[model samples]
Target: MPEKLPVYRIPDFTPAKALSRGIHVADLQAHRQKHAFVQAPHKHDFYLLLVVRNGQGTHTIDFTLYDVKPGSVFFLTPGQVHAWDLSPETEGTLLFFTPEFYRGNREADALRQFPFFQTWQHPPVFNVQPNSLSPVEQLLHQMQQEYSRAAPFQIDALRAYLELLLIQLARLYPKTTVASEENIWPFQLYQLETLVENHYLEHLPTSFYAHALHLSPKYLNELCKQNLGKTTTDLLQERLILEAKRLLTHSPHLNIAQVAQALGFEDNSYFGRFFKKQAEITPEQFRQKR
Candidate 1:
């Protein structure tokens, strides 16, 4: 039987450098291939825009899995855990860029206005119908060709083209208007939920957020339930449990107490009960079986 591949950070890009401003198109695809870049559920502090030209599989992001098909486009923002399970024959153009790329650009910010880019109550999935894909296909082909050309201002040209692509995406997406039926409280709660998920390692209590957001504990709970369908405590517990599971499955060498401490649990016994209650087994036993 083949052994399970250990989950680890995808190797940092080679040419062995970072993209301070922009990257060439071929380098982007080659980086995906060179890193054995079948990413396991992970998050980054940057934006990723992927246009699946030819591929079919599941792409998991932040506790959700999306179906991938030809011409499907997906947007991932910073601090969202995502993974791609693509066919060996998978073909796609994935652009990774910092939020700074779109800094001060109104049209680029407009892309974030869509619900598809938010921490959704439902999964974010889009399938391109035949009649609606010409613009995106045109953009992808143009990006590939422009990237290959040797010109003095090629990087600047790529940036302009990429921004134009983002603008088209904003137009193709449905807009969000502030309707009377929509509650602002839920939006606030979701924003808080994202903060906790992204920084739970800091091991903050609910009061910290309440204080930060200028609200009380009771009000926070109400808002969370209304917006995200979960209470504040429920969201915190879920985040902790998910991280625990990731460590158990990915970091096999770590023992039970080590795992507990890594998750900011000062009381080992309490951590065991908390995990067992959610998982129905003690951590050590859970690790052994899995």
Candidate 2:
């Protein structure tokens, strides 16, 4: 079997005390120099917001390759595998924080409110216009300064800046149907997406997620369709197919049957048929193409 992908937690890079508070800010190039291992494909347990002020390269996130350039901003949620190769001159800031840190005294679905952070709805990366990049750069620098000072109530100050930064970026993001005070359905949809992420490996049905959300399956499907233009089953199947592809492409040592079993498919043949139906390609073909 292929070795399991490395999963990094905030404590891996930050001091133990910061681990409790769950936030880290760093100079992008300096951080990269200090931790060369991050250049390899790996997963993180905390959320990451990386802003590239100047760079030239590629950042591959969950199999999608994005250009790494000036004004590029990348947001990564927990469990999304990514690796990047930036120029030696790359300059930017990286903000790492846990859900708990961002959600302190806020609603449970706070982080999900940002469209970019909702990977199911939008891509994880966006580029800021040079004219508009100044504000964002300032916010990042302010956060870095506050993080280094360790002043009293520093956590509160950092959290406030983080939210402001998210707000600024949201404005730059392509307009979409985002959660708002007048609408609770988007929040519910976010909850459902989160549930799917946590339970997709189990191959749970829509009814299971519906019950967990205290909504009927039919209504849940309606919510999904209205917000995401997809049914609950479609969401679940897509999540399964994404993970299957990830395993097939990254874990070359694992055969088809092993990948199927890893994804909770008891029968390799059945897994093959399911994969082809959803991905429109055989597992071997997909693996070879990748």
Candidate 3:
């Protein structure tokens, strides 16, 4: 069998302190040298914010390729696959934090409130305009300093800076429809998305998630349509298709039948039909093309 895609935890990079804190910050070039394996496609259990001060190459998230240059900012949530190909001269900063660390004492789903963190809803990459780069650059520098220091309430200090950094990035995120705190739809949608993420592999029905969110199936569909331009079923199917693609692309040893079984489809033929309907190609064709 092909090796399982590596999933890294924050502690993997900073074994001493990250186990307890669930956060780590590093200078980009040194981080690249120290963890060269990161260049290979892998997943992370923690969230990642990579701010590129200067770089040249491509950062691939899921199947999308993003250009790397000065002021490029990328956000990655847990379980997403990503890899970067950067020049040796690349210099920047990387912040890795888990949802628990970012949430602290706030709402449990605090990190999901940001559009960038909603990987299903928005692309995870953006560029910082040079004119507006100072504040963001300064925030990253402050975070690095705070992370490196040995001081009282350091976690709290780091959390505060992280929150500020997220807010700053959210403001600059392009054409995002970030809802106000009082808005219920966005939070409800986020909750539904979270539920889907957890249960999609089970092939659960849309009503299952609707009931979990205390909303009727029809209203849930309406909310998804209004906000995401897709139905609840579409979200579930799209997620399945994405995972199918990932398996097809990364797990060369898994034959089509095994991939189908892995994805909760008992019938490999049915899985092939479903994939073609949603992805516009057969599993074999997709794998070969990839």
225-252: candidate 2 lDDT, tens digit per residue: 9878999999999999988988997788
- Which residue pairs does candidate 1 place in steric collision? none
Candidate structures ordered by TM-score, highest first = 3, 2, 1
Collision pairs in model 2: none
Q: Which has the better TM-score: candidate 1, or candidate 2? A: 2
TM-score of 3: 0.94
Task: Evaluate all candidate structures by whole-model CA lDDT and list the values in order.
Answer: 0.65, 0.86, 0.85
Q: Quote each prediction's TM-score.
A: 0.72, 0.92, 0.94
Per-residue lDDT for 199 in model 2? 88
Clash-forming residue pairs, model 3: none
Candidate 3: clashing residue pairs, number: 0
Candidate 1 wrong stretches, greater than 4 Å: 1-11, 14-32, 37-43, 60-66, 79-83, 104-112, 120-124, 141-190, 285-290
Q: 1 or 2: which has the higher lDDT?
A: 2
The runs of at least 3 residues in candidate 3 whose Cα sits more than 4 Å from the true structure, single-residue gaps closed, are: 1-3, 18-21, 176-185
